[model samples]
Target chain A: MILKNKDVLGLEELSAEEILGVLEIASRFRAVFDRPVRSVPIMRGRTVVNFFHEPSTRTRISFELAEKRLSADIVNFSTATSSFSKGETLRDTAENLAAMKIDMLIIRHSSPGAAHYLAKVLECSVINAGDGAHEHPTQGLLDIMTMQQRFGDLRGKKVTIIGDIAHSRVARSNIWGLNKLGAEVTLCGPPTMVPGGLARLGVNIEFDLKKAVAGADVLNVLRIQLERHSSKSFPSNREYHRMYGITEDVVRTLKPEAIVMHPGPMNRDVEISSEVADGPRQVILDQVANGVAVRMALIYLLSGGDPGALGVGQD
Target chain B: MEWSWQRIPSEFLVTGVKLCRQGKLGKRKGFLHVRKGRIEGLGIGTPTVEGIPALDGDGLVCGPGFVDLHAHFREPGHEEKETVATGSRAAAAGGYTSVVTMPNTDPAIDNTGMIRYLIDRGKEAGLCRIHPTGAVSPGRDGQGMTEFGDMVNAGAVGFTDDGSPIASGGLMSNALKYADVLGVPIITHAEDRSIVGKGCMHSGYWSARLGMAGMARAGEDAAVFRDIELAKAAGAHLHVAHVSTKGAVEIIRRAKNEGLRVTAEATPHHFSLDHSRCRDYSPLFKVNPPLREPDDVNAVADGLADGTLDCIATDHAPHTVTEKEHQFDQAPFGVVGLETALGVGITYLVNTGVMDMGQLVQCMSETPARIFNLPGGRLEEGAEADFVLFDPACQWVVDADGFQSRSRNSAYLGETLTGRVSATFRGGRLTWRDGG
Candidate 1:
């Protein structure tokens, strides 16, 4: 079946076949991006609203760029300056937005299931940019797309995630997407940073970074949110860097052809050293660019268009 | 002596129903006779009288009224949510004839005056019996013990510092010792607040994934363990409230096996809904000792089935619509539970085969009554005819509008349930009847 879901909530809710379909359509969009003009009028008449309750730079730019490319009118709502700052409820704010006859709503909320709640209230298509510690599906899609572009197939590929696996919505979405794509995933972090019982999801939980990175083809490192953790839950930041930090020394443990990735705003020498992040094996920058194309594909498919029927997406 | 069944002038007679008396469900068909606020008499077969007011109790179960060991009426303070009158109506609708109101009220039920108010107000409503549970601490602040002796004399059946757990080990020991001497059990909300800091839901995959803060199992288990240790030393009766985690169950089970004076309770929400239900981040799903995983839910069911848990209490906390309408993190942590407790227990426990009808009644009524040393939970000749008649096979949808509860924060709203409380009688009078 085609993507009949009106809301693109999470990767976990999407099947492997649906994920492949989105990626295939995304690959076709890259050809459009390379054009000199890089503008499509397929959605010229439609109005899309980016209602972000959480602050973001990269993800906001990525979606704005994609919506402009699709020729859809964009409405960006800043939570800091909105009626929400005046003590209005989320439902009240969302209903006011929906009254504008917006075709789609791209929401980045601090609370989990915020988008799911909005999707039920609004008649428009809802896109979850990022929701709480829940899934960031577009980020997940782009990360997997970047991996698929290089390897062609991700079946049986070993993907290792290190750093703050307990609080990373990125890690959760990636786990769902990567596992669906037949990748063997291993999550590594401190005992308190990585959640318990992930093994039930077929994930291999490793406490030692050295052991986790040994057989890895991909290392997706998460950033440490120092503000969220106390000195007790965190203990020592320097100690965390010493044991779990990704540096040139740890890079030697990976396979020769292995890649390193991060959803950034990265801490320079903490989560990854500059050498490894700027090295030839680093695909972090590519993930940012792929983010736009995958998001454009999602908007088109969820707008009730069959990407499989599009002759341009036959590849 | 053959009595005339047809010519009696009693309010109502429930005939041809099976009853769960004490712990055993009856095999023989029996008819309950009611008159002047007491069980006049009961006999087998169609009562021999035909003209009397009667209801067809075919395929239904009659038992001593359901008793909730714990609940928050929110009265004497948060009346916007519920008062004794509204809460008792909710209780009667749920087939409960008696309930122990937790001491964490507006001013907190710490004195004999509050205890007196609750009973008088509950009686005035003409619904179920509402026993005010005295706070362990004077203000429920975990500082000093309340007048347990005076409160008991004022008609309080138990003592507890429920909403805020009595965190001080020393203070809890004192409360337990004092409650024991006063002939009342000390029920406590068990969770070490220090370890549970800034956490909202159960700490696990769901909390990690949902980005919501977590209340770790160790937070609760540590408190459960410490309390059991103290109870052993004090030799006092300790009633654990809302046992949710698996580790807590193991500790409680071991305590019971060792014959310590430990009794624990589990809620329907704990045994039926898991942490995954919080995936939507509805404040409706938020609660203290928040919903746990499936394994933990099963463990609660196992605890109940194996007699490790003494009773199934509603913990019928009510909140107003405005209070619960906020975003997940911004909203309060409780849902209206009184109206749906019986339906949920029958749907999840009895129908799922985890418990039989008799076991379900014992957990809801007999056991809680026994533990608290209260009256009722039995259908005997001289006892007041406080009974709940329910259709175990009745299938109905739960709607917040249909509830007698003042607040409509039910977690089971819109779900279809297998059982319905048909009629409830308090002191031989029909206090509540479905669709009546």
Candidate 2:
């Protein structure tokens, strides 16, 4: 089935079937990576613009590589390089881009609803790379894809997200996507960093880090956003590491088959230790690998490519 | 330009209208006899006096014109959004005859001269009575106090640092004490800036789900708590502005029960809308004290019904379209409410059975007038003929384009409302008529 939406703003708006459909397509795209000629002509002639109002490294390159592999023409705009620095409003820039008749506009803004705002103004498809602490839909899908690769079925899986759940858009998107896929989601963080209101979203909030990771099927660790001004929530890096950090001791509390995940760039020893970063059961790199496929699937589907018809011509 | 307070002497009889007055709706259709600029007589039935032009009110409900205790007439500064003239026109269109404008202007209305300038501008417009509020601090900087006595003498009805909270407790206590001496309410914007730092919307499930920074309800609550204690210590009237959280309502309710001079006002948007309205990321919904959860909406509505909230103030803030067009986080914190306040009251309160029309009118008109101790909330013999005619059942959609205010940044834009104001009159002269 083709994706019904003109924009992939967030995972919160998508249905379970729609999410699985994108993941299914992503699995097929994931296989294409093994081939010598990984490039596909699915998005041929379509122009995609990567508009990063905020700084990024992994999500941008992953999307760029996804666009290249899908054969879509790509143009990149970062805050330092774009006319945005010249005091052009997002609407003004979006209007100019719409004037150029681009196919899809991928935005990464520091504001929460920046992507949603542009999607309403532009006739073209819009993908949210990361909007404030809101959602990173493709990242969510990639994380979900990585989990499904390990456990196959997420139903009844205890996925514990530990860190600044209050400010993590990755945690939000994952909560929505994982809850839709019937995963039992538990949030673990310091009291100040974990908002109890999220419990209304049908997730359990656990303040104790050990109790949160205990017998968990998957542990998705979030980075301590020292830059996002969340430093006031906890005392220091040493205190946070001592209290909630995912060290080897914390990882050993999990079930033998349970895996650990972190949406990078990890704060090294702050949120997760180096031993756990390079340790077994941590699928951090696999998450990065799946990100391209997930983004490629979304771009292909939102570009009106048929999900059922993938690999038919190229195979 | 020449400005005159004197209106053309007029004689008219408003007949066949349901009159709402003194916390009750008249059982029989009545007629109001207006001579010169005051109500000559008003009672149930036809007037004995003849030779006066008679206006057919039809099935419309006539009540004392609404008095807004809070509005931002962006004048002497941000004229691109709203001037005193345009804001007064909007007030008249919304069936308001008197509006208390907030002091958070370009230069901040902290001085006596600025207060007089706004009153003169209102008279120049010849639409509504404009009562300017003085800022608590000279620049609303939450620092030292403004000269309350001089500002009040210059026709300032109240004092507030409304766009931003009076962050310091000592300064707030001093402002309240000084305002008490001047017999004016110190209107607080009621937010703890430290708690609400960078939060664009209500801190709750939606903020968590949307991934935006949440403005915790504790901010408003803690600020209200502090302000109420300060008012108690100062023996002053603390009028809480835009009381959004249930915690704020409870605090105010307890303070009122203890008989501290605390009067509070809730906005139409706060009572009717919720944080879910921000789901679209529309800056229109990005109000300060941000549209709260449904429970808070119910609490506000209940607070108004039970008199914990003393009045319904529009907090009629206006911003330019381009300014509001920015992303939600970057957009200004307010929605234009001058034109939509009455309709929202009727639609959300009266029609929903939360309160009857008389109570709603009392909240909008009489209580607001009493809260700030303003004139013209009563329709009685030998009083200035400041009143409004509105059809309680008239269903129409709100169009911001049709607003008389310079800006179209209304939260109720495109909403279907059950009431429509037909006409407004101040000082026996027609200020606004439906089709005109």
DockQ of each: 0.37, 0.58
Error of 2 at B254 (Å): 1.8
lDDT of 1: 0.86
Tell me how many clashing residue pairs each candidate has.
Answer: 3, 0
- For residues A254-303, could you state the per-residue lDDT of candidate 2 as single tens digits? 79999999999999999999999999989999999899999999999898
lDDT of 1 by residue, B1-436 (tens): 2233334344567888987777778888888877777887776666765555776778878899989999899989899889899999999999999988998987999999999999999989978888889988888888998888999999999888898888899998888888898888889799898888877899887787677778999999999999999999999999999999999999999999999999999998998999988877788888887899899999999899999999999888898776676667666788778778888888898889898888988899888988998887768777888899888889999999998989988888889988889888888777788887
Query: Between which residue pairs do clashes occur in model 2?
Result: none
Model 2: lDDT of residue B247: 96
**Candidate 2 — which residues are off by over 4 angstroms?**
A80-86, A306-315, B1-9
Q: Pairing residues by index, what is the TM-score of model 1? A: 0.90
On the 0 to 100 scale, the lDDT of residue A45 in model 1 is 85
lDDT of 2 at B207: 86
Each model's fraction of native contacts:
0.52, 0.71
Instruction: Report lDDT (Cα) of residue A39, candidate 2.
Output: 98
